[model samples]
Target: MNGIFGYAATAPSPSREEAARVRDVMAARGPDGHGLWSSSDGRCVLAHRRLAILDLSDRALQPMRCRDGRYTIVFNGEIYNYPELRRAAVAAGHVFETTSDTEILLYLFARHGAEMLSHLRGMFAFAIWDDHARSLFLARDPFGIKPLFLADRHGTLRFASQVRALRAGQGIRDERDPAGVIGFMLLGSVPEPFTWYQDISALPAGHCMSVDASGVRQWRYTDLTAILSAAGGRRGDRHAALADARAAIRDSVKAHLLSDVPVGLFLSSGIDSAAVLGIAMEQAKHPIHAITLGFDDFAGTTNDEVPVARRIAEYYGAPHNVRRIDRAEFLEDLRAILTTMDQPSIDGINTWFVAKAARENGLKVALSGIGGDEMLGGYPSFVDVPRWVRRYGRLARLPGLGAGLARLMRTVVPWYIAAHPKAPGLLRHTSTIGGSYLVRRSLRLPDDLADVQDPAVVKAGLARLEIVARMNATLNPMPDTPQAAVSLLELSFYMRNQLLRDADWAGMQHSVEIRTPMIDIDLFTRLAPLIGGLPAGIGKQLLADAPNKVLPDWHRHRPKTGFSIPYAGWMAGIRDLDQRNGKAASSNGLLSRTWSNYVFQQYPAGA
Candidate 1:
């Protein structure tokens, strides 16, 4: 909801002007106010740009200090359970200064230290400056819903809400990270713990770090895969599971409506967004405003979401706003969109325009249904990954046999099978849940990238990224079922690295906060027990029935086309434009793969 930047160093702190420059780089994220706080000893500084969603008073402004003067904090996010946490703090003999979650966080940290993270139920990326301890503590939410990028140089650590902001600070080196560039080529987005710049890295989700005279230390406090694995055997009755899921959805939707300003919903034809709209109408004290993005190219076609979403809004009796865009608008906004992008991504173009429409309509916060698929087995990966593991897992265990067979097929098989890019990977990766999921989700395989990128860069990047190893680690002890394993892979990698990260930068670019009820930790906790136990497709139906009335049969049974735009056709136009102008453009391979290459070429590392 805001932009935060600061630094803690063994040496003197960066100049106040320099820190403010970093904060100002994210001015669009927080247009309401700005502040800077520096320690008297010049060891640390905290700066903030305020969007003023929860409490619109100067009293709520941060870098806020605790009453005891021991702790000062700068935070960027909402703590939905702060009202409950505040009551506990008051009972524990703490006095309050303002009705803001940031104050409650400072008091809780004073009382519980790092243990306070477990008590929180919201999205956040924050840094607390302990003046007395002369140490800095930084933590990101369990889902990485908010971003925190860090750069350490000469024992000085700098943190910001954005990678571009950190680069604008002019303190970190501008050297390109080879792993990061290749990561974008392979995955269409730079994976966490790495960034486009060698000097900057994203803080991994569910993790925290501390910097002091003892040097910096980082650790994980929560792991979603571990939680899901631990709850594997507790498969209760199907009816009871459905009831629990409904209650969790309602509770999460109500909590996400915590903003003081009017809240809105991003309505779509999909079950995920429609379900959210229905629940919000039932729970919100006021009428919920709903917004949907429609493309002129698909206005009369099945791909357009406007008509279906409008009918859903009418059924809920909520105010609806539809924004229709055309190819001309896409061409005009392409430059600004790329510049606003914090990293190279084949995704986020849809999010960018939708968030822009929300802001234009005077909405400061909106709820999205992004995480529903990953949590409820709505993706094809759920079926394909498990089947691959079951059928070809034994072949993978034989190691060289699988590899040798794959090589033989590529060289000697029929042209269609031999020329297929993923055919060899399917044979080689079908052994483990991680490998199978990779085959399902990778934008371009390592072998595919080898045909485009330098072999040395591809080799080094794969080694540093350790893509499959990292994916498998999320399933640490391994889930009890293939379904649960695929869920962990999708949530831990695709959602964490791409969906959630894209939502953050895109929403912030337009100064709108996009909240995801489907992504809540509490909701996931309540439904984790029944992940692999329930019948296929039943989980989504449970969500559809969460509100007072079940969704229409036509709405629930519609084939999943996903919320998307006409990107392929539009990119073809862009390619044509570039070719006519004598500029190089990628014209071969899958649209997503070529789009990934084009995005990197425009926003290459260190640019």
Candidate 2:
């Protein structure tokens, strides 16, 4: 993994020093080396900061040009299947100077053009400067596991692996995007295609863009929901489905282990991390290193993941390291955490510390169990969303009646139920899978966003965001079952927008590359046939049993307590510290809300 930045312009391009300054903004992401390349005509420039994972040789250094120099590329991700792709390139009469995946990527694009995206199998956000065509081709991974932000001003296009990196460059405007501001307020993270700044936007996952004299054009190449929806025709017996799922998990775990450096696992009490650890042990030639994050507050309580994670490591005979963090450490690191954050998010605190632990332990690459909940039926939304759609869906179809009933329930019900924020949206959201999911995952309901944001901004932002409509679009060619629908929603929205984005910024903040085997496109495609066919909850069990060893009964049956930090208690401590220092303390309600407000305050949209 690395930090990549460049510009393509109709006018004289940005200077090498300017490009280098933007690349250096993400210095933490790449500590190995740096390079800069500019077109002879001075219309395009590419710069890269290398972490040097796959090939540790200088030959693999990039802004790497093809043999004939028709293509020059700056890439910021790993391509897991590069070995196989390289063999094919060689067989087709291409020569390779380095064994790096970036070389293979350049060759594949030379041979296949945009079609090369479908052949890739890892996280990436890359820009290829086609010297022959005199255009720039930019593409992001299907899952958006890596980030690419773009800024277009007067036909000069600047792109980077980070939003802040783009902002650090000259000529990019800093005007706040109203939709982005409200999206962050409503979702705790800014949604895709919008950033905190109006002048920059994310390159949507599963899509590619080409910039040339005719201007820019973008088009989607893959859609996960559509893949799942079309998979209904391939259903098989439950036993066969389980077998397929096991094979897919093992294959994915094996593929994600593609690294030259010592790879580690982020083990937790949850089945997802534990399962990945088990499979890694079975497949690894060397004992895998397992890292777990433990909190001082939860050390002895059931919430602590240390003891259980340690036991799992022992069971696998892997090296184990538990890094214990306290409220004091959290407070001390607060400023740095917010500063390193690529954009405002409420979810990266845990990822931030764990990634730090991995880097401190001398690990450059680590595997995580991030997408397990969405891929398997692990989240409560899998059960609750479908149930809500069935029960209140009909009632929600009636416009005024549903809203009236919601108000009536609030007036007459018990205080706890009346005060519950989601209850008010029940009637409005239950009509469809997307609407129900918005209720399940939103940090604040649309009506409640007005409390924190200007009413006019709230109104205009909602109109521009069209959150519900976009969520619904992900369900196009809708899946056969509610379970599949919710899974698609969770994967496309929560995991894609928040979890994956957080992992990118947080992991890169510490110069560590965190890979997710559970989020593999190949694995998802292989198991697509079983997604709507298998009984609920069986997918996770299949994953747990993928390895040869049997997991302890306690782990399999343990309640799904998600990986969490004591943020509420930590924030309260901050408030107390502020009061003692004669400063105004931030008001508290929901911890998520408070943190969201705090992050926004630190990186105010207007600024």
Candidate 3:
């Protein structure tokens, strides 16, 4: 992974020093080399910190311009299919000055312009300045595997791979975005296009924006849900679908392993990680390393992943490393973990530790199983949300009944029921896929936001978030089947906002690149047609039925106890969480809320 930062202005041009300062702040993301380029007229500047994953010479250094010097780019991602793209570009009369993907990308853009995004496959967040057109084009990858944050304020447009780096730019302020703060409180992470800062915004995943003398125009270059819907209703033969899925997954894993540096797998007892591990090992030319994280509190319990992960690693003949965390170690790393977080998230601690372990073991890149659940229906939302919507959706029509039940649930219900969070709001979202998802995924129910956040902020945030309306806007115009609906909701909300963002920050903090083969856009486009119409649980079967049978039954059949830390116990000691509140920090729910608040306090968005 690399870091990219740049600025474009229609008025007073920003100085090179400002872009360099942003680069300095993000140096950890790309320690290999650094460079800066600016237009002669001083209207634009681009800076890059290179990690040297591909084409490891100085010629590959970025902020690169085309052979004709008509186009300049500062890019921060790998183009997994660049070899093929390069071959096509060469055949199409495009000349490349270097073997770098950056050069290939620049050439491709020169030939195809914005149309180039559809021809590429990989994670990317890049800004290309068209010297001739006098326009700046910025795009993020399909699934948001990479990040692109922008601050468009004070007559300047500044962008970076990390939000903090964008904040480092001149003329950007740290004023709190009420919607973003409320989003953090509701979802434990801020949603796209709404960073914690009022002036800063993330470019939504799978979308691109162009800035020129006229104004800013943005559009979705690709839509996963639309792809899924177009491919829905194809309910192919089960055996054929399974075979296709297995083949697609294997091919995606092979593509993801295309880095110059050694890559490893984050092996867990779960089916997702195990499946990825198996595929990666089969494709790797050398012994692949597998890492597992365990907690001392779960040593003798079924919750421990180390033992099962070790067995799977041994079966594959891969070197296995188990990093066990005792309370003492967790306590020691608490400060660093919190500090390294780019945003306030209750999750990502597991990723932080696993990535740290991978770095310690001399691995520069590692693969994770993040998208498996969203892609293959592993989450309960696939089943539960649909069931709830089906059961309670009709009752929602009886005007006051739904609201009355929600009021009762909020005032008198036990915390366990309340902790389900979305239960009360179930009636509201029951009518549509977007609404059902909000109920299923919300950390704090709509009625309960006042308990954690200011009433004014909550009102403003909810209005701005327009949670259901915004979600509905991302949906396919065609109605989605139950399975496809949940998949779309999860991918758009939880997976994009939490999982992918967490993976990026946590992995990069330790200088380890984390790849998710299951998260590939091309793979999803291929498999969506085959499984989009299937019922909730069949997607898992499709993924598990690999032709080689590399996964053992024991590991695959094990109950899905999510990869978790003993955060409740850890927080009790670290924050005195148990005694600070009137209630015990007995459940992950309360502990999560406490920790979320603490993380926010430590890294306040407004600050």
Candidate 4:
């Protein structure tokens, strides 16, 4: 993993000192080396912080220039298919400098421009300067395994790999975005295209943007719905589809394993991680390393993941380490974890600890089974949302049915069930898949934000941030089946906003790279047609069956339990924080809503 930062200006040119300052903010992402480059006219600057995963040589240092000096690129993330891409480039009469993927990427873009993104098969966020056209091209990998943030200030477009880095060096006053504040409260993480800051924006996943004298333009290079749509009801035999899905998974894991350093697996009790370990062992040339995180609260209970994870690791002959985390250790690292947070999120607590453990073991990269649920029919959302729609379709469409019931439920329901803020508002989302998803995943209903924040702010934020509309926008080019629709929603919203982004910041907090092989666009494209109408009850069945029966019956057939922490109990111990009172208020009842707000206050925009 690395960090990229740069600015392209039309009138107000950037300076070398400013670029250096931006690069310095993310020095931890690339402790091995750093570089700064500027155009001859000083209108553009590119900076790179290199983690040195691919080629550990000075020749691989960037901001790398093309052989003819027509283009310069500052890149972040790994290009797993660089060897094949390099060979293709060479066959097309391209010359090479270093064996680094960064150079291959620059060369590929030099020849193919933005179209080169289609050929890429790894996680990346990069900016390429076309000196001849005085234009800059920026692209983020389809799944957003990497992050990119941009800001417009004084006629210059500044961008960075992280929001904090962009804020630290953009040289502008940051204002809190009311919509982003509400988005976080409603969804537990800020939605795409909006950051907590008013001026700065996160580049959406699966899209590219360009800045030139003509102005800025953005377009999607790929999207999950579009890819799934291409399936065109082409599902074949069930057995054959299962075989193809397994093959795709195997290929993806092998591809992600391409690295100069040791790659480890974040093994868990779930079938997703177990499947990944089993597949990696079959394809890998050497022994795989595995790490599992367990909590003291669930040491001997079914909730403990260490025992099962340890069994799978031993089955695969991987060197395993069960990182037992206790309440005292969590408290000790709570301050640092809060500080490492790039944005306020209630999730990522477990990720933060696991990444810390991985780094302590001297590993730089680890594979995670994050998108397995999204790709396969692994989440309860797959069934619950559709069922809600079926059961309450007509009533949900009544103008005031949801709002009226929400009020009644809040007044009468007990704290345990009522603490789930969205339960009463279920009817509001049942009319459409997008609306249903918002209610399904929401921490608090959008209409309830007024209870926590100012009425004016909540009103204005709700107007600006249309949660239902945003969800529907991802569904415009719809998938063929209800199951595919749920998968698309999960991948676009939950996996992108929470899981992938969390993995980036938390893993980088310890300088450990977290790779998700199941989330690759290529792999998704292959499995989409086969899994389109997959039954929600058969959670990850294709994956569980794909590993040549490596998974034991319990690992594959056990009840689905998520990797979780006792956040409510732990946060209660922190004296500085307001303890959760058993009330159905929007602000203090739920641990997620309270923690999200606390993190925001802990690290305010530009803090």
Candidate 5:
């Protein structure tokens, strides 16, 4: 993982010294060394902060010059398939020096042009300067797992890994983007293509843009939004979908485990985590290394899941390493976590810490079960939406007290299902604007957000949610079913915003990389449609369907417990101390809360 910064002028004239300043400010990202490259007349400048992962040799350090010397590249991320691409290129008569993916990426474009994107199957964000065409091609991975930012102003085009680096560039400052801020506070992370500052924007995932003397143009090469934003399919076909899910996911797991360095697993005793462990154990010739992630607050409660993790390890006979985390450890790491956040988010703190542990365990790569819910109806919302649709149907046809009470209940109750835990689980399905938004990401409802709404935010959230609903209506054609469409919208809008961003920054902060097998194109494309097709069941039942022997009985039946930290408890503990000492504690220590109150002003408790 590395930080990349560069600027292209709308008109020529940013100096080398000014470029040097941008490099200096992002030094923490690449403490090992830095490099600056520019065209002969200085129409552009590319700066790289290196965090040596692959070669550990100067040859691997980037802002790399091309084989024919016509192109230069500044890149971050690993191309897991580089060795194979290198072999094919070498067989086709190319030469190489350092065994680095960065160099391979340049030549891959040199040989394949735009088609190279289709060939790439790893996380990445890279800037390729084609001297021959006098153009710069900037591309992010299909998943948007790596981040790239662009700020265009006064005829200048600027880009970087973090917004701070962009802010440090000469002749640049931006007004805050209101919608992006509110999106962060309510959703816990800002959705892509928008940043906290209005003038700056993210290069959407699965997209590539090129800029030169003529100007800039962008094209999307792949899409997750289209798949997840659909309605139900035929229910009876699930048996085949389950079969497809099994083969496709197992193949991705095999591909993801293909790393040059030691690979480990993050096991949390959840069905998703245990499922990955089962496949990993089957593939391992020797004991596989696993990290059981947990916190000290659960030390006294039965919430400590380390024992279950140990049982999985015992079953697999793998080497299990238990690493306990505490509030002090969390507080100590809070500042860096803030810095690691490219945008404020409530989640990812736990992801960052786990990656740190994975790195400390002498591993460079790890596998996580990230997409099980989207594929198999794993979330409670997916299971209940079908039931609520039935209840709502009955009420619409009735002409009595029950009908009036049902309408009254829905209006006063945040949702119809709060009457029982199962109801919250059911009606809170991701089918409509409010319910979909809440199901996927919101820590607070629109009603919950009502307490902290500034006039601007109310408008923006409503507009965004309206756009999402309309998009779902247009995209999802399945009749009599809204679950699949809701799942897709949630995955596209919220997952990309919160989950993937957290994985990228948090992992990079610890100089480690995380790979997800379930989201692999070949896998998800086959399984996602079958989710809402089945009568109410677990969101990711396809994952658990692998075999009864593979998972714990409790895990198979457990409620969907997010990979979460007890943030409310953590916050209250600090609050008590502040009251006693007559000082205040920052909710900023928690990304979600920080974004909610400071950025969006929408925490349920209010500032």
Candidate 6:
């Protein structure tokens, strides 16, 4: 990904150089080319590092200035429908000096301003400076697949793809904001508008912040929940919803495949990735390279959908290969990963392994199945959470028994599946608001944390709970069901922290670009309206019922297993170490011990 860093004031050259250093630090993202530009009046400076993807011509090197010299932009994303947008722009008699989408984006903004965001469909987070208007325009995508950091320290405003990029600047981050760090540990990553250091903020998804000397104002341009509520249940019924969903998926995959570079597939035994492969194969002229990942020596059942992946690949006569991560290498890579993690997360390692394979296979870009579940009610949480929610009414009226029953649940369930059957994994995953599933789902609930751990840690959690509660209150004004809220929670939390970060860094570690066809902006707008009123007994039922133009039944049944990790089976690793001494390490809950020991602690038949 590329970055934008600058100072709009007539400041010291060294100050601008410091901003340039922040942009330069992301060089691993851009090895082929780089450039920096300063406005003739010296009031603005823009710097960019590049990875040559499309039209790898020198003309595409950016910090691109508009023909009228009224604007400059530094963007980090692909305009998947660039060719189509180009046709429209050209028809309007707009001239172009380069074939890159970066140019089209600048020109589109010149023509449409913020309105340009709705017409373009791809993952993006960008910053634009209109010198004539003396304003800075910044935005992130509806799905937030790409990241942008915004920090306002004193009077200067700084932005970049990663916070580290912003941190590289000398004068930025004047305050050591521990509140963000507290939020990070409590929430697994800091929430939007809060960063590890206090002064930095993330520009939240679907929102834009426009700043100039007059001051700054932030506004949200999209709200999927409201859109879904307004769309209602009629269009989302099983038959009609499926049709719109199918059309959206195919169109998005087609647009995502519009790169000048050799694109490949990160095929897994899941419907999402399989759907991507299936759709791309129809339009692709040559055999596409497909990749599958596995653990060769581990004793646990390998979540190898390699068999399923091969079934689909062989059926299509597509060329494919398998890559393995033996136990030893997984350990070795895990250590390097921790230091390189940029953000501490349980994901990204899976992406690291596969993206490395794709890079070696000579593909510069790959497609993923992200956003498929959120759009289609594919998660069990969408179903199971509501079940527990029904039971929650009974718990509330019971008064004193509520705490007792929740605690009783903690003791009976096995560590492996303690919350299983009672609560869906989704509700248990994040600390999102008002889901009854939280009773069955939490790793360790607030009371449990208060009872067993450090009081200081518990107090810290309570403080962040206050923050999340306020956020929940803010979102309450928008309308939708528990399902829609759960979907949004996943998007805000897991998708950003786990999936997208894993995909981007792992791919970039090899300079490979991983694209998600299912997450196109227009496609999301179309599908968001169809998600609310789903029928029971069917998962991703909407997508399943659609008349798929290209995918076979083999791919059609590919469950969303996602990059499966062997979470069970006794292994001699830090997992065991973490179990024994990892209590202090857990920001969430304490891991449970073996059954015999727990039973020993209780032991009387009627005790």
lDDT of model 5, residue 163: 67
Instruction: List runs of model 6 lying over 4 Å from the truth.
Output: 1-14, 41-43, 171-189, 233-238, 298-302, 397-433, 437-443, 448-461, 465-481, 537-560, 567-607
Q: Which should have the higher lDDT, number 1 or number 4?
A: 1
In TM-score terms, candidate 4 sits at: 0.95
Please give the lDDT score for candidate 3.
0.79
The local lDDT score (0 to 100) that residue 239 gets in candidate 3 is 69
Clashing residue pairs in candidate 2 are none
Kindly list the per-residue Cα lDDT of model 3 for residues 270-336, writing each as its tens digit: 8888888877888888777999998988888988998988888888778999998778887788777
Off by over 4 Å in 5: 1-10, 15-33, 225-241, 282-287, 300-302, 385-441, 445-450, 460-481, 526-541, 544-549, 552-559, 573-595, 598-607
Q: Which candidate is the best by lDDT?
A: 2
* Reference-based TM-score of each model: 0.95, 0.95, 0.94, 0.95, 0.81, 0.84
Q: On residues 1-607, what C-alpha lDDT tens digit does candidate 4 reach at each position?
A: 1222234333566766777887787877888898988886577888888787788889999989888888988988988888898898888888887888988888778668899998999999998888888888999999888999888765678888887777767465667788888888899898888888888888888899988776789999986787788784778777777777788888899899888888888988999999999888887777778999988888788888988898888887889998988889988987877776887787898999899889889888899999998888888888888888888766788898866776777778857345466677675667888888888899888767777789887887888888888888888687777778888889888888899999999998788889999988789888977654776655487788667655777778898888888676677647556664412232454666667667766765336
lDDT of 2 by residue, 1-607 (tens): 1222233343555677778898898888889988888876677888888888998999988789999899999998889888888888888888889989999888889879999999999999998988867788999998899999988877778889888888777787767888899889888888998998889999999899998877889999988888898887778677787888898989999999998889998888999999999999988877789999999888788899988898889988889999989999998888888888888898998999999999999999999999998888889898899888888889987878877887677678846542476787788767888888888888788877877888988998999999988888888888998888888888888898899999999998899999999988899998888875656677778878988896778788787787999865687655423332222222223557667777887873333
lDDT values, one for every candidate: 0.83, 0.84, 0.79, 0.81, 0.66, 0.64
Compare candidates 4 and 6 on TM-score and give the better one: 4
lDDT string for model 1 (1-607, tens) is 1222234334555577777888898988889888888876677878899888988899998889888788989999999898898898888888898988999889888878999999999999999988888888899999889999998777678889988888877567877787887778877888888998899998889999988876889999988888888888787677887788899999999999998899998999989988989989988988999999999878788999999999989988999999988888888989888887898888998999999899999998999999888889999999998888888878977969878877787778846452356777777887888888888888767766787788888888888888888778888988888888888887887888789889988998899999999998898899898776666898898889988877889789988877889875677557523432222222333567667766877784344
Worst 10 residues of 6 by lDDT: 598-607
Cα lDDT tens digits, model 5, 369-488, are: 776765555666564444455554344334454435544555678533332212332233333433443534455444345556676676776575443444355344433446665456
Model 6 lDDT, full chain set: 0.64
Worst 10-residue lDDT window for candidate 2 reads 579-588
- Candidate 1 — which residues are off by over 4 angstroms? 1-10, 413-419, 575-589, 604-606
